[model samples]
Target: MKNVMISLAVMGAFGLSMPAMATGLVAIPAAGFTGTAYTLCNTTGNFGSSTPTQPTTGANNTCATFPANEATSPVSGYTLIASTNRNAVIGGITVGAVSDRVWRNTAQTSCIFGARFTASNIDWDTATTGTQYFEVNDIARGGFGSASVNAGYYIQATNASPVYRIGRTFTSVQHRAYKYDTAANKLLLGTNYLDLPTANSVNTALTGEVTGIGPTVVASTTSATQDAIVNSNWIDFTIDVAYVDDDGGSNIVSAMTYVEAACDSSAVSGWVKTGAIRLRQTGQENTTLQEISIDGYAPPGSTVP
Candidate 1:
């Protein structure tokens, strides 16, 4: 919703009032635990190597997803949407760097399969003192591959060794009960056990597991609703992401240009050639500058020429 408004505001500012036929815009809000640096489910913690050891900041050999309200511990009550695919394949969002395997918990005792996490009330993250960054953790896997007490996930100090035991505030965006019957980008993928934060910049490497994305935006029906001037010949598209804070941290972004496709100038190129036209009316073959009216599209201040 906020991203759309920003796009429209840019148009109006430049005298591009929402095209008359521009009925509505779609927005994809990222609602879930983006990532809060938590501790690895380590046993030896010597960057714990595994028969199933979660080294200092790593993941494990299991994956699971759920609907909201299924409890984990510390925090609960989240309806965040997420998804999971088999064998390192993610959906929707762009994929990045990949690794064969990093240190993780494979130990039987430490590898409790079904675990979950939720949000935290603590001020672990602050503009100043910058510290603590892990996305989500499977708390049940804390004491992985055989070792001592399960201590980690929630911590008390800046980068202080992770709180390795239970009965502490762990964090995440959603849990089992929040799962809706239908969703896409809302879902999360990957072992994501004991995730570590990359650099502060938006584009940087972070995790050691395979992650994929589902579709961020919902689908629309063909020839669906449009505004007063629907120019079907060309689809006007605007995409944006939140760059900085707005009314409690939002993703309001600006412009980017289009890239030519790989099929440019080829037979299957998106642009149609003159020979492709099939006019039923006589003398139309030689005529140009014809205005096409798209179904359900009504462009502003535009009359069929």
Candidate 2:
């Protein structure tokens, strides 16, 4: 009986489609449930090392108390307050309602300075039947998904343990933002976001058969950098693979197997590039060839700044 042989190869292709999702203007609260306000006074010494004293000696030094209703519920999304002076103003959310609790300096006027609210210490009442939602502002600071609701990006959180939701399906690239631990020091992406049900399924879908080789062969490349420009903080990756198979001998040999090239920014880490080319034997040493190239881009904002 003639030996029937099968050879399979798999490559990691970085290229994937990311369609723009609708986003909306909304306020997310800061990480800490509460915030404190401080007042700055004048000093006559060297401006660099000199410290300012409180406007008042001891008791009266503290400015007017912050408003009561000012401990804004998740309702008031983005609120702005005027400066009482270059210094004195409400210090906390206690005495009365103030428009904006957070303040910005004249230099930062063009910038929206708001708290990136997070529900760390506060217990998230997910069990409540009502609209169990929290609000945050200055979302551009730190948050997953886009600010626009229509943009399809939204914040999601999970406890330290796994929680299952039934009747929901997700694509391979969909992600959810969640707290990984009690400290809330870091935000994490769950593998569940990848939504891969079984490892074998991915293996089968990407596997290709080996066929032939070409006279022209090329080696892989590598690139690295520590400092990068803002919008340009992305790494492009490409990989090429070459292999051959022999049917009569029921054997296969890899001609070249390596990463083509990789680029990275100061943000994300542990990125690699890879590709594959397969050849199958038609007769003795004759073969058929198929080539596939894989590429991906890693942007800076994706990781810690």
Candidate 3:
């Protein structure tokens, strides 16, 4: 339940254009970055060229695109690997639409989980409200299957869930690890409750959570709250595979980087549109070019890389 601090570095960028052949959960390297910042992009398509395209500020670049309606497969570029039954009812609440995808660096060293969604209004849970099942959000290893829950580790926020009894508005983000049963097809109780910001940044109370720094940008000190996820917004969280493993979990890192995984935002109920769930390799933990740790586990003096 401690606050993790890391200096904010400029968001890195890539220049490679989307390729037609590159598709699915294939790992591709986002050019090795020299600065402490990790390379990032808003790619919705395939990867091409020797250097992966870097992201720039104010550019809502398109790596993948969907039509006016929900898309089973991306119109162009890579396809989503996860199943369709994404937003299952948890804690007696039904998450409207939670579409997800995964991307990785070719090195398969670092891993990131990103969930995108569109909503006109965002909801928040307060301590006074007791518990509202739909207020929480989640990032899990498997898609919310039709018949059963996926067997793996999942990170769920407390919101107002009785599990942690969290009541704060912004601080409601709980970083607890829960396991699912393959045999039973259900989610087990959570353990290892670590306090985490709803969004990973110097200040979780600002738009910086949604508006990321771009490749050319040198540095950033801006801040914003966990605002609404509208207009196909994407929020990414760095996954510490080793940290989870040390805490009695296994294969989570491998499943995320090499195998299959899914992340979704239940922050908004009755979501208008669902976006791609993506994963990207950030290299191993404690690296000079790693993204900010979502669980506040940044190495001493580590800034966003």
Per-model TM against the reference = 0.15, 0.15, 0.24
lDDT of 1: 0.18
Using TM-score as the measure, name the better of candidate 1 and candidate 3: 3
Report the candidate with higher lDDT, 1 versus 3.
3
Worst lDDT run of 10 residues, candidate 3, spans: 1-10
Model 1, C-alpha of 124: deviation from truth (Å): 40
Off by over 4 Å in 1: 1-45, 52-74, 84-305
**Tens digits of per-residue lDDT for model 2 on 1-305?**
00100100010022221221111111111110011000111111111011112122232111111122323221122223221111101122111111112222233211121221122222123354432112110011111111111000111111100101000001011112122122221123222322112221221111111222221211111111111111111111111111111111111111011110111223222221121111111111112221112211112222311
- Model 2 stretches astray by more than 4 angstroms: 1-109, 116-189, 192-305
Candidates 2 and 3: which is better by lDDT?
A: 3
TM-score: model 3 vs. ground truth: 0.24
Q: What do the candidate models score in CA lDDT, each in turn?
A: 0.18, 0.16, 0.22
Ranking by TM-score: 3, 2, 1
lDDT of 1 by residue, 1-305 (tens): 23454654464355342211111112111110122122222222111011112212133211111112222221122111211111111122211111110111222111111111222222223442532111221111111111111121221112212212111111111111011123321222212222222112221111121221222322121111111121112111111111111111111211111110011112112221221111010000011111111111111221221
